[model samples]
Structure formats: C-alpha cells, structure tokens
Target chain A: MDKFTVLSAVAAPLPEENIDTDKIIPARFLKTTKRTGLGVHAFDSMRYRADGSENPDFVLNQEPYRKAEILITYDNLGCGSSREHAPWALLDFGIRCVIAPSFADIFHNNCFKNGILPIVLPHDVCTQLMEDARMGGNARLTIDLPRQVVVRPDGTEVPFNVDPLRKKLLLEGLDDIGQTLQHEKEITTFEERRAQAQPWIPRIVLD
Target chain B: MAPRTLFDKIWDSHVVETLPDKTAILYIDRHLVHEVTSPQAFEGLRMSGRRLRHPDATIAVVDHNVPTSDRTQPIEEAESRNQIETLERNVKEFGVPYFPLLSARQGIVHVVGPEQGISLPGMTIVCGDSHTSTHGAMGALAFGIGTSEVEHVMATQTILQKPAKNMKVVVEGQVGPGVTAKDIMLAIIGHIGTAGGTGHVIEFAGSAIRELDMAGRMTICNMSIEAGARAGLVAPDETTFEYVRGRPFAPKGEAFDEAVAYWKTLAADEGAHYDRVVELRAEDITPVLTWGTSPETVIPVTGTVPDPASEADPGKRAQMQRMLDYMGLEAGQKIAGTPVDVVFIGSCTNSRIEDLRAAAAIAAGRKVAEGVRAMIVPGSGIVKAQAEEEGLDKVFLEAGFEWREAGCSMCLGMNPDRLTPGQRCASTSNRNFEGRQGPGGRTHLLSPAMAAAAAVTGCLTDVRELI
Candidate 1:
C-alpha cells in the first residue's frame, strides 16, 4: 500500500444507521483462512442485483464514487456483530476513511488496525456530508491521514483526532499483534520473569 | 477523594499485578468457552502442553454449530458434526466440565452461565466471545477475549489488560408498554452513536434501569460491546440477589446471606465520578427496528429509512450511502412491510426464558408467513426443558413456528441453519450485517417478540399490535 496525502477523491453517502459487520463482509467470506480477496464479496447482497449484476442505484455503481476512497454514513455504523473481517474487506475495497455519526466498538478498533480511519462527527454534521455525497460521482472528498483532516469539495476542512498511539501504529502499519511483537525484547524479559515466578510454565522458544 | 464505585471495586480486585509497563495482569475468575472459538485456544494449550490452570473455574458448551430444531438426528453437515465431535473429544480428554448439545445444561454460553448462577457479582469473567459482557448485569467485570488470549487465561487464569475509562449511561423515567430493555438499548445506541462508549465501562443506572427484570438487564448489558464499551453493569440490588439466590451455582443458606452482605459493600458511592455520562429518557423509546446493514442504523419500525443526503458531515454521508446501497433500501422508505424469508429468535442476546416467552406470547394464535421460516431456539437445554414443561414449546409449534433446542443458532452462520444468499431475514439474533447469517443474506435485527411478529406478518411490523 502506498502512503499518500489523500486529496479530494470522492465521498459517497449512505445514511442508514446500524450497518453491521456482516453486511460489510458477510459470513461465508469468513470461512476462508486468508483475509485477502474479500473486496468482491463486500456487500454482495446490496451491491449486486438479484440477477447478479451491479445495482445501478448503489452509491458505488454511481458516478464519481466509482473511484471513491472516502465514505460517509449514518449513526452507529458497524453496529451489531464484532467481525474483524468487516474492516479487512472495507480496506481491500479501497475505503481509506469512513466518517460516521458513530461506529460499533469492535469494528472501530478493527478499522484502525486495518488503516481505515473511522471519524465520528455529530449527527447534524453527518447529515450535511450525506448531502454532499448525494451530488453523485463528481463529489470528491479529501482524507489527509497525515494531518487528520477530512476536507470537503467545498474547500471545507474537518480535523478528526485519533488516539496518538493508534495513529502512530497505523501510520507505521502496526496492528495490535504487530505492536505487541515489536517489543520482542520487553516480551522476552517478561517471559523470563514468568519462567522464574511461575516455573511450572512449559518452556518454549519464541524464535 | 470520593469512595469507589462498583465498577472500580470489581476492576481493582481483578488486577493481579502491574507489569513493568503500565498494563495489568488481570486474573480471571471464570472462563467460558464454546465450540468455535475454543478449539483454537485448546489447540494452543495442547501445543504448549500446559494443563488448564484451574479446570474447576473453566466451563464449556457446544453452541455455535449445534442445530436447534433437530438434535434427534446426527448433524448432516460433515463440518458441523466434526466441530461438535472435536469439542466433545477435547473436553473428555481435558477433564473439563462441558454442556454437550443433548445435555439438559446445553445452550448459548452467556445465557447458560447466568441461569446456572455461574455468573456472580465481584467476579472477573472472560469468554472467547464478545457478548461475555452479558454477565455484567450480575455486577461482574466481564469481557470477551481473542483466541490466543483465551489460551493465556486457560494457562494462567488471567489475561493482560489495560484499565478502561469509566462512563455512566443513566436512563430516567418509566419505560412505557411495548418498550422493553431492547428498546432502551437501541435508543441509547442512537443517542451515544455506537463508538461513543469506546474504551469505557458503562454503568446503566437510574429509575428505568432499576425497574428492568434480570433478563431485561442482561439484554441491555449484553450489547455493551455494540456501544464500544468494554463492559456494562447495573448496581447489584434486591432484583439481582433474587435472581441469584437459588440457582445451581449460587450460594445457598448461610453462604447466601454472607455473599449478599459482601456484595452490598461493592456498590458505587453516591458521589463517585465518571469520565462521561450520557442520559436517555425512557419514555421516548418504543419498539425499534434496524434498516441498515448495521446495528446503529436502527429506528422505530414506523420511521422511514434514513435520507443520508441531508446529513451535514461529508464523511458520514458517504458511509450512509454505502449502508443504504448495501441494504437495497431507498431513503425515506417505510421499514414496515419489508418482506422477510427467515425469522430467527435466539442468540446469546435474547434466547433466555423471558425472551422465549415474549416470542411465544406473540405467536399464540398467529400463523407464520407463507414462505418465512421461523425458529424459536431457547438459550439452553435447561431453558428448552423448562419451556416444554411449561408448554411454551407447544405455543410456538401451534403457531406454525419451529421450536428448537438451545444453542447459538442463526446468530452467526457457523452452523448448518443459515440464510441463503439474498434472503432477507427478521432475526432476533444480534447483528444485522449483510451475510451475517450466510452468504449474501440480509438481516434485520429485532427483539424476540418483534421477530415473531415479523414471522407472522412476513414483514417488518411492530410487535405492539400483537403483544
């Protein structure tokens, strides 16, 4: 993945609340061991017509959103089940930033780990963004991860704040497991303490 | 300085030791395991050749892949049968207590724990599932852990942790008729915006909370994860003690009084402060329905699907369009009369006896929709047996709905009973995410009675009419 100071691309709007993880990436896709190649299956039910074609009315199938990287949604986005696959699928589908009135807990953490910025704006502000995205394909929005700014096509800039630790990890592409492992030296020292304190623990080599 | 709250007491007691780094080594009092998530953790333990630290404190059940409607026959699916078989083998080998699918104790882990009195106040619990917070209603400090974390607890009886910010979500006024705990939670989700409670432990209080039944309080605390809170709790009181008094694992006789006396000391001080406090008016809530591919995309059934275009936040608008598009819904469309094919009324969230009664009450004289498949799965084998003894099973069966055994059926598509592609379902199970039930399946989340109502009507109708 390339690091870019994201400029005005496109912002598509979907105002329904409680968009859960299953809808973001359904369960069947979950059976696969590999997390890659989930983009095609993302929102398969709604994105495709019953006849197995793209739903023209879908925001993704519409104009400027064809190249959209930023998405705006309604309240409680990513509500319901906690499936990390939701963020993985969204990231694979090219969604770099999601601005919502709110996000489900597990999904919010998943988003940050997968390098998707979930910006929570107030409900009134969310309503305004939805209108801008509804203008169709030409509606471009800029998401500058470096500056934590979500800029609108109208030259308006909205700055969002994330936990500093998480921001650094995401910028450096360090997931939770990755973050924990990055301190291999410290983890090893802790393991030594564990071996000394709870000697019953079966010794295993990390390397 | 002010005195500690119940949340602080529970959290402080669980903190075993602070590491050189700031994180705490939190000891787990009870560890709950199920078929799907447990397999890997057990495998990790086997690979490391570590005996479970305290087998007595660990409990297991076969739920996710267990069929609720027909346990009389072998699971036809090779994979499902294998998973359950593996769990049975693993439990036997490890000498761990397990609630097998056909056992009288079997059901969803969350519901089973509380009903068995396994979830107690002032205890720290961990499950390999997110809804573990469901036990918080009993005033326990509980949360879900991942596969590896599950193994860590199994080996050492503790998990690494960081302290959470405190939040108090207080609900006032009396909840009106047709407004159950489910409605209060949905309304709160709407108010707090899902992630509003992230990194926080939410204490649900005030008059309305005090009035809720045990099952209702469990339902509210169960979805705390949905609000991004690490846990949700209600201060233990008479209602809490009454529910815990005579359960199989709860204290009895002399022990009971001693437990209650100790429990009272854990209550929050009158002036204990919180990092955040969000208030909700109970009277404002009604039976709610979710229209989007998410949980927070909920509105009253009578309300129209949202028009995201009118939202002021550009970031939120784009996300809203995706939700509406993925849900195959248009802005401002009525949620009612949206036809559904499957109606599932069971999960860790709402598969308890109270939930079953609510669904059965709505189905008493109603016939299910022509093509909709409706299932009422109790939360556990005990619940199933009790319901049958009380004839609640017959009530649903006579109503043209299938009365199934207890398990985490249709909550997630880990089992054979799942929604087919593009099938719209009215599910009482939490999570309305697309394909959550199966590939390309659409889920509309609702309460047990609401799901039953949808089954009867084959559309998204409010349950108030029948209830």
Candidate 2:
C-alpha cells in the first residue's frame, strides 16, 4: 500500500444510493487470483452493455469522467457484501477518493487497507460535491488527509474528520499485520495461559 | 464496577492484548471460509510462505459458486469452476478440513458452521462474508472481515480489531400469528436506518426474542449486517445447548457438559450497561415488504409506497424518489396486490430446514400462479435430504415450485439462477440492493411463508390473510 496524504484529481459523479460491492465488481469477475486487470471489470454490468459495448449513459464512459480519480456518490455506498475486490477495483480504476454521505463499515475499512480514501461528509456537502463533480474533467477536488480538508475545484473547502490511528496508518502506509506484530510477545503469553486453562481448546503446532 | 453487556463479556474474554490506541489483538475461535473470498486469501498465504496457524480451528465450505442445478455435472461457468477448484486445491494443500463441492456436508458457510456445531458460545468467529454475523446468534463475537484480515487470522490465529460499542434491541410482547423472525428483522432494520447500528454489536433480548428458536434467532442475526451492526447475539440458553448437543463438531459427553456450564455464564449480568438501546413490541411488527433498493426502505405488507414529498429531509426525499423510479412503483399505491414476477426463498439469511418448513406449510395444496417463477432452495444438502425425507420437497413441487439443491441459489446471482432484467421478485434473502439478484432485478425482502403466498397469488399478498 502507498501512503496517502494529499491527492488532487478529477471527480466523477455517481448519485445512486446503496451502490453495493456486487455492483462495484460482480461475483463473476471475482475468480482471478491477482488484483490486476480488474479495472476493466469495475462496475462491469453498468459500464458495459449486453452487446459488449460501453454503456453511453454510464458516467464512467462519458467524456472527462472516464479518467476521473475521485468519485462522489450517495448514502450507504458499498452497502452489501464484504468483497475486498470492491476497493481493489476502485483503486485499480484510478479512483483515489470516494466522497459519500455514509459508507458501509467493512467497505470503509477495506478502502483504507488498500490506500483509497473514503470520505464521509454531511449529506448537504455530498450533494454539493456531486453537483461540482458534474463539471467534468475540470472538477478537480483536492483531499488533504493531514489537515482533514477537501478543497473543491473552486477555492471553497469542506472539513472532515478521521480516526487518528487510521489517519496515521494511511499516512505511514503501515499494513495491519506489521502493526499487529508489535505486540506479539503479549499475544504469545496470552495464548500460553489460555491453552493451559482450556486443554480441550484446539491449537495447531508448526513443525 | 459496571455490569458489562453480553457483547462486552464475549469480546473482552477473547482479547489477547489491548493497545493504548484502543485496538486489541483478539483470538479467533473459528474461521469459516468460502469459495468466493478464500481463493485470494489462500493465494496471499502461499505468496508469503506462511502456513495456516490453526488448521483445526478453520473450516472451508464451497457454497457460493457451486451450481445448485445438476451438481453431478461439471460446473459450466468457467469462472465459477475455477473459483471452486482453487478452493479445493488450497484446502487440500493447507491440510485444512473442507466440504468439497456437492459434498453432503457442503453448504452455505454460515449455515454449515452452526448446524455442525463448530460455532459455539463465548467464541470469536469470522469469515470473509458479511453474514458471518449469523454465528453471533450463539453468544459469540462474530463479524465479517476483509480478505487481508482473513490471511492475518490464518497466519496468526488472531485479528487486530477495535471493540464495538454495545447495543441491545428489546422486543417485548408475543408475536401475532403469521409473523416470523424474518418479519421482525425487517421491522428492526426499518426502525433503524441502514447506518443506525454502525460501530455497535447488537444483542437481541426481551420476551419475544427469547420465545424464538435457534433457527429464528439465526434469521435475525443473519440480517444484522443490514442494520450496520458489527454482529448480533442472543444469550445462550437451554435452546442453544440442546441444538448443539448432538451435532458432529460439538463437544461430546463430559466436554459438552463443561462447555454448557461455561456458556451458561455467558449472559449479561443484571444491571448490564448498554451504549444504546431500542425497544419494539412484537405485536407491532408485521409482514414487511421492501419498496426500494435499500433494506431500510421497507413498509408493512398492508402499507403503501412512501411519497417522497412527505419526507422531511431533502436528501432522504431525493433517495425515495430514486428508489421509487428504480422499483417502478407509485407512491400511495398499496404494497399488497403489487404484481411479482418471481418468488425466491433461499439465502444465508433464511434457508434453514425450519425456513423450508414454513414455506412448505404455506404451499401445501396450493399451486403457484401462472407465469410466476417460484423456487425453494434449502440451506444445505442435509437440509435438502431431510426435507425430502419429510416430504417437504413434494409439498413445494406440488405447489409448482422448483425444488432445488442447496447453495446460495438466487441470493446474489453468482450462479445460473437469477432474475432477468426488470424482473421483480419477492425474496426471503436479506439484501434488496439494486441488481442484487440480477441485472436490473428488483427485490422485495419477505419471509419464506410470505414468499409462498406471493408465489400462489402472483403478487405481494399478506400471509396472514391467506392463513
């Protein structure tokens, strides 16, 4: 994962609510072992038509929005399923930030783990951002994580808040495994005590 | 000292270490894996040269991608075949116990874990699927995790997690006739918007919840994710112990007694503190039908579509309009008698044998309405076989339903079973998100019995009326 502090990019507008993981990347495209080549499949059903041609009405297929790096969406974005592929596809599609009124918990966490910023703003601000995003390629919004502000394409800015630890981890690009290992000694001691207390509990021994 | 809520009791007991930042390293008692999400996690394990830390504590089941139809034949979809095959290869290589595709033991991961007694009280369970919360019904701290976290648990047998705030939903009074757990769950979600329970683990209690059986509790907990809760739990009691006593993976004899003794102490103390609380009267709950894309956009079966103009919040008003447009429904139109193209009754949420029994009871001596595609999918192969032995399949087939094998059939449309574009269905599944069952498919969440009612009427009809 890459450290995320400040990003400035064109914003695309997807005003639909409850844009679930299955819509972000359908289960049919989830068979790949690697995360590469998933950008084309991001929003697979909506982005492409039954005849395999691009859906002209899809915002991602429209001019200027095709290269959008910031996505502004509605409430309950990424609402269903716990597929990590949702964030993987978004990041692969070059979307660095998602602005919404609210996000499903798992999807929000997955976004941070994959270096994508999911910004939760007030509903009115999200509405304003969606309108700003309709300005096409010229709608460049800048997110400053350290300062907790989203600078709109215009000079106006919207303030936001994030958990301090999450913000630090995002700024430092620290993976959860490495951070968790910092307390390995305590974990090992606890496991030993638990194993002694519950002999019937199962454990696996590595050779 | 405060009397901790049930969620706090289970969560605190599993913590190996806690940091000043409030994150804790919690030991995982069981990790369930499925074909859809485990392939990538297993691949990551291989790439990192790490072996599973606790293979005995992990169980894999191929459910999501398996074809519910013609199990003896090879899976026709190339992607589905590859996903299932990769799981088999990975499970074999890791030396982990797994139920292969079409195996009698293979079922939806959430369904298999509990039915086999692998999910126990006072344990922390996790899977890469959101319905992992279904295990929390057994007095456990269970929630969904991402694939990266799945690998973390596989390699370390622990996950770094922040404890969720505690919430209790108290449903008092007895449920009226024809009301089921599915109806109560929908009512709860509608009461609290989709994001209301965010960052909280909800414990279902009170008289009505206590009256529910294990299967009913599972149905409620399975949809906890829809309410944005980290997990849902009910204190383990005699009903729980009886359900687990004879299952294959459960402890035997003396061990079982000891486990039950421990589980008996898993309930909240008399003055337990909750961060938040919501109360509902069971008599107030009714058969629910979702009129929009989100689970929260629901009303009682006897109600009508909500008019957006009546909404106080501007954003909510806009959302209602969008939902109405997608659903092709007019505000103020009654929900009942609204035409339905299909009736699907199966999912991790409501596909257990009891769920099947409810549907079968309603379908007995009735025929599905002409032009309606009605199907009943059992939760597991065992459930299917048991239903057949009890003639539940006959009841369904006689009613003109397609009696299908187990798996997540027509739930999220990963397989061949799905609705076509613009099709509207009355479903027993949890989600009603846009295109969840298929491209341009509209879903109205309902109970199994209500789905049978819809199948017979060719419209959304109140099961109580039929009864």
Candidate 3:
C-alpha cells in the first residue's frame, strides 16, 4: 500500500450516479490472479469500443483528464459488488482520491484499505467540484489528508470527515493484517473459549 | 438485563478485542471462497510467507468462471480455465477444504455455504462475493468483504470492523397471489431506493417474513445488498432449524439439540430497540421488475417505464435518461408486453430448488414462446439432482426451456452462457446493471415464476395473468 498525504492533480468529472464495480472493471478482465496491469482494463467497456479502439467520448480518454489523479462523481458511486479490483484499478490508473456525494459501503471501505481516499461531500459541493474539474489540467485540486480538506482551484477549502483510525492508517501505509496480528494472543484465547462454549460449530474435514 | 437486537448479540459475542479506536476485532466463524476473488488473496498470503491460520474454518468452490455446460469436456476458454486451476492449486496448498468443479456440492459460494451447514445460526461469515448476505438468512451475521479483507481473515481468522447501525424492516400482512419473496424484495428496494440501507444491518421481521420458508427468506436476504444494506438476516425459528437438522455438516443428535437451544437465543430480545425502523404491508407489494439498469429502478409489472421529465432532480433525471438510452426503453412505455429475447432462471439469488420448482410449475404445460431462448440452471449439483428426481427437468424440457447443470450461469456472465449484444432478457439474477448478462445486454430482473411467464409469452407479461 502507498502512503496517502497531500496530492494536487487534475480531477476528472463523471457526474453519473451508481457507477458500479462492473463498470470500473468488467468481470471478463477479472480472470487474472495478479492485481497489477489492471489499469489498462479499468473501465474496459466504457474506455474501448467493440472493435477495441479507444472511445474518445469517455472523460478519462479526453485530454488532460487522461492523466487525472482524482475523480469527481455523483451519488452512490461504486454501488455494486465487493470486488477489491475496483479500487485496485483506480489506484493502478493513478487515481488517489474520489470525491462523491455518497458511496456504497463495501467500496468505501475497500478504498481506505487500498490507500485511495474516498471523500464524501454535499451534492451541491460535488456538482461545483465537477464543474471545476471540467476546466481540465489547469484547475488542479488539492486533497490535503492531514488537514482533512479539499482545496479548490479558486483557493477555497472544503472540510470533509473520515474515520480517525482509517485516516491515520492511510497516512502511514499500514496493512490490516499487520495490525490484526498484534492481537494474536487475544484471538487465540477467544477461539479456545468459543470452542468450549460452541462445540457444535462445524469444522471443515478435507477428504 | 437490557434488551439486545439480534445483530448486537452476534456482534458482541464475536468480539476478540477492541482497539483504542472503536473498531472491534471480530472473530469470523466461517469464510467462504470463490474463484474470482480468492486467487489474489492466496497470492498475497504466498508473497508474505503467511500460513492459513485455520484451514478447517474456510471452504472454497469454483463457480463464477466455470462452464455450466459439459463438465466432462475441458474448459474451452484458457483464461477461465486458468482461474479455476489457480483456485484449485491455492486451496490444495493452503489445506483448505474445497469443492472442485466436478463436486456435486460445488455451487455459488453463498448457496453452498448454507446447504453444507457451514453457515449456521449465531456465526460470523464472510465471503469475497457480495451475495454472501444470502447466508444471513440462516441467522448468521454474514456480509461481503474485499480480497484484502479475505487475506486478513485467512491469516488471522478474524476481521477488523466497526459495528454497523441496526435497522429493522417489518413487512406485515400476507402477499397477494403471484407475489413472491422476489417481488417483496424488489418492492422494498423500490421503496427504500438503492442507498436506503447503506451503512446498516437490517433485521427483517413481521408476520409476512416469518411466514416465508427458508428458501424464500434467503431470496429476500440475498438482495439486501441491492438495497445497499451491509447485511440482512431473519431470526432463527423452526423453519431454519428444520432446514439445518439433517444437513451433512450440521451437529448430530444431542449436539443438535444443544445447538438449537443456542440458536433459539440468537433472536432479538423482546422490546429491543432499533436505530431505524421501516414498516411495510406485504399485501401492497406486486409482481415487480427492473425497468432500468439499477436495482432500485423497479416498478410493478403492470406499470410503465418512468419518464425522466417527471423527475424533480436534474441529476437523477439525467441518470434516468442515460439508463433509458442504454436499455433502449422509451419513457412512459408499458413495461409489460415488452418483447424479450431470452430468459435466465438461475443465480445465487434465486437458483435453489424452490426457485427451480417455481419456474417449473409455470412451465409445466406451456412452451417457451417462439424466438425466445429460455434456460434453467439450478443452484447446485444437489439442487440439480433433486430437481431431476422431482421430474422438474422433464417439465422444463417439454416446455422448450433448456434444463442445465448447476452453477451461476448467466448471472454475472463469467461463463459461456451469456446474452448477445442488443439482446433483452427477463432474468432471475440479482443485478440488472449495464452489460450484467453480457455486453450490450439489457436485463429486466424478476422472480422465477415471472421469468417463466415472460418466457412463455416472449415478453414481460404479468405473472398474475398466467397464474
């Protein structure tokens, strides 16, 4: 995981709501065991035509936006599927932050784990940011994690809320497994107690 | 003692420890793995030189990319075959119990978990697939997790989590004729919108919910994800106990009695408080279908496609217009009588034996309308065998609907069973997202019986009329 701090870059605007995980990366491209190299296939259907040519109409395919490190979208973004590939693709494509009015629960959590910041703003604020994003590479947005604000191109700052622990973890680039391993003794004790209390909890017997 | 909600009881019992932050380390009792999501997690473990902490607590199956066609033949697609092979190798290396592609028990992870009695009452279950909420119907605290979390669970047998808020959805009154659990769920999503249940765990209660069988309850809980709920569950009762009693992995004899006693205590205490409460009358629900790409874009089968012009919000109107354009539907057009090219009757949401029986009952004496390709893929091999024994296969075959082996065929379109571009379908699958069936495929989600009705009529016909 990469540490996330302050990032100032061009933000692409996709005002559509309910941009599901399938749209981010279709199931067809999910066959790969490795997570890297998915940026090419990110938003595969939208980015490419049926004949495999790039769809120039897409926001990400347009000039300036093609190198965007931030995304501004509408409500319920990333609404379907729990596939972590959605965030992996975004991170692989160099998108470090997503500003939306709302987000689906699983996708929101997945973003924090992958070191991508998912910021929730009011609908009006998101619409305004989307407008600001349409100005292209000239209007770079600054996401200051330590300060917990999104700095607009016009030098305006908008505060956002994030879980304190998640925010801290993201700044340090720490993985969850390492944090969880610290409680190994407690987990072991809990398991022993549960085994005695709920002996009927079925265990897998491999053939 | 103060009253406690069902979620509170399960979550409290699973807590291994609480960090300085409010996040609790919740011990997971079961972890279900599937092909599409587990491969990367296994690779992570391998890269870190970490051993699976509890192989006995995890189970793996290949479903998403496995061909629903002849299992005897080699998989034609190299990528799909490689993905399945990767899971096989990973599971074997990790010493995790696995149901191979050919295993009679092999099916969608959610379907197989409860069928094998691995997902029981008062347990915390996690899967890489979003439909893991389906197992919550078994009175378990089950929800979906990402691959990173999957790796975390595999390494520590627990997941770091902040407890979700409690929500109670109570559906009173009996559903009218032709209204099934699918219809009820669709109605709930339509009423609540896609993000209504976000950040909360919903407990489905009331007379109508209690009246549903285990399969029906599973169907309702399965789509709770579509409503944006973290998870949904029905309290354990005689129905849930009866379903688990004779299962292969369920506790035996006296152990079963003790387990049932514990399961009985898993329900919410009387006068328990909920953070939010939503009440509905089941009688008000109708046979509903998705008219657009999103699950919440649902309307009664008798209704017309919504006109975006009527939407108050400009942003929502634009989204609706885009959905209409992609679905090739005209505003204010009738949803019923819209021609369909295909009918798919299977998925984790509605591929159990009961769902198969419902579709078969409607197809018993009718033929699939001309120009329509209808297929029934059972949920699991066990379900397939049961349907065959009950002669449902003959019914479907005679009705011109292809009866096929069990897997998540045409659900997420990971397999060869898919809708061609520009094809319209009446499907029983959970999602109706753009290209969910296949690229340029338009999906209208409904119940199995409704899908069967559409197959016979070659259109999105009202199931009540056929019944």
TM-score against truth, every candidate: 0.77, 0.95, 0.99
Ten contiguous residues minimizing lDDT sum, candidate 3 chain A: A198-207
lDDT tens digits by residue: candidate 2, B41-152: 8887888788887788899888887788877898998988888888889988998888877678888888998898889888899999999999988888889998888988
Q: Comparing 1 and 2 by lDDT, which wins?
A: 2
The ten-residue window of minimal lDDT in model 2 chain A covers: A198-207
How well is each residue in A25-82 modelled by candidate 2, as lDDT tens digits? Answer: 9776777767667899999878998788999999999988888889988888887789
RMSD in angstroms between candidate 1 and the native structure over all alpha carbons = 7.0
Better of 2 and 3 by TM-score: 3
Ranked by TM-score, top first: 3, 2, 1
TM-score of chain B of each: 0.97, 0.99, 0.99
| Per-candidate TM-score, chain A | 0.83, 0.95, 0.98
Better of 1 and 2 by TM-score: 2
Better of 2 and 3 by lDDT: 3
Write candidate 1's Cα lDDT for B418-452 as tens digits.
88877888887767656678766788877887888
Residue B247, candidate 1: alpha-carbon lDDT: 83
In candidate 3, position B73 carries an lDDT of: 96
Q: Which regions of candidate 3 fall more than 4 Å away from where they truly are?
A: none
Each candidate: what lDDT? 0.77, 0.87, 0.92
Off by over 4 Å in 2: A45-52, A131-139, A154-159, A202-207, B312-314
